[model samples]
Target: MKGLLLRWLILTLAILAAAYLIDGIAVAGFPSALAAAALLGILNALLRPLLLLLTLPLNILTLGLFTFVINALLLMMVSGVIGGLKIQGFGSALLASLVISLVSWLLTTLVGNEGKMDVIVLQRRDEDHWE
Candidate 1:
């Protein structure tokens, strides 16, 4: 449960970052960003898989690049559903989706699957061995 909340917060931050960086994407405020993130998560959880399965052929043909289109479409749908989040056009949606995906992925890597900051440290125990 804590991990889920952390993940959601990460997503909210990503949305805010996208709005900040993308000219065509607008988020009313933090509350709006939170709501948008939650809706986006729900949609991704429920609808994304179905859409991916339906578009498997095209996805394969495009070497999985078609996933970006699917993500953009979903982002546009989220904008339509959320009153506070606005995407000007398909191009904006595409760019915003890319930004959001990148930010989310980068943050998630730092946070790890358990939603806690993960760190790795290496030490040399001997001349020929490291631990």
Candidate 2:
């Protein structure tokens, strides 16, 4: 629906911003960046969850830090899918991923929480409204 498309665009913009902040995250232009963003979304949707599940023990052992590596790998895979989105090397990809995540997190989290998105605000008119 329209909401999904909007979210996709927002994510694309976030990635584009992140690319500007970090090295090795390349897109030729706006169109290329958009395409690469969509590809990244697709790759994350298709692959990331499985990787997380497979690496659950590692994730647990690492206190969920291993998820960052998985995310970086997914970003690199996305670069491979989108021809113009080139990551120079694994380390670069990892660093770019970290930057991308941090930037996106900061933007989305700016409304209220610190580094947490998907936030919903509820206004209470009366204390009894929650009952």
The top-ranked prediction according to lDDT is 1
- Model 1 C-alpha lDDT per residue in residues 1-131, reported as the tens digit of each score: 88879888999999999999999999999999999999999999999999999999999999998898999999899999999999999999888888989999999989877666898899999999989
- What C-alpha lDDT, on a 0 to 100 scale, does residue 70 get in candidate 1? 94
Q: Mark the regions of model 1 whose C-alpha exceeds 4 Å error after superposition.
A: 120-131
TM-score of 1: 0.88
Give lDDT tens digits, candidate 2, residues 1-131: 65456556667777777678777667777787788778887878888889999999999999998888998888878887788787788887778777777766665555333323465677787986742
Model 1, position 112: C-alpha lDDT score: 74
Query: Which pairs of residues collide in model 2?
Result: none
* Alpha-carbon lDDT, every model: 0.92, 0.75
Error of 2 at 47 (Å): 1.3
Q: Assess candidate 2 and give its TM-score to the true structure.
A: 0.76
C-alpha RMSD values across all candidates: 2.5, 6.5
User: For candidate 2, what is the lDDT?
Assistant: 0.75
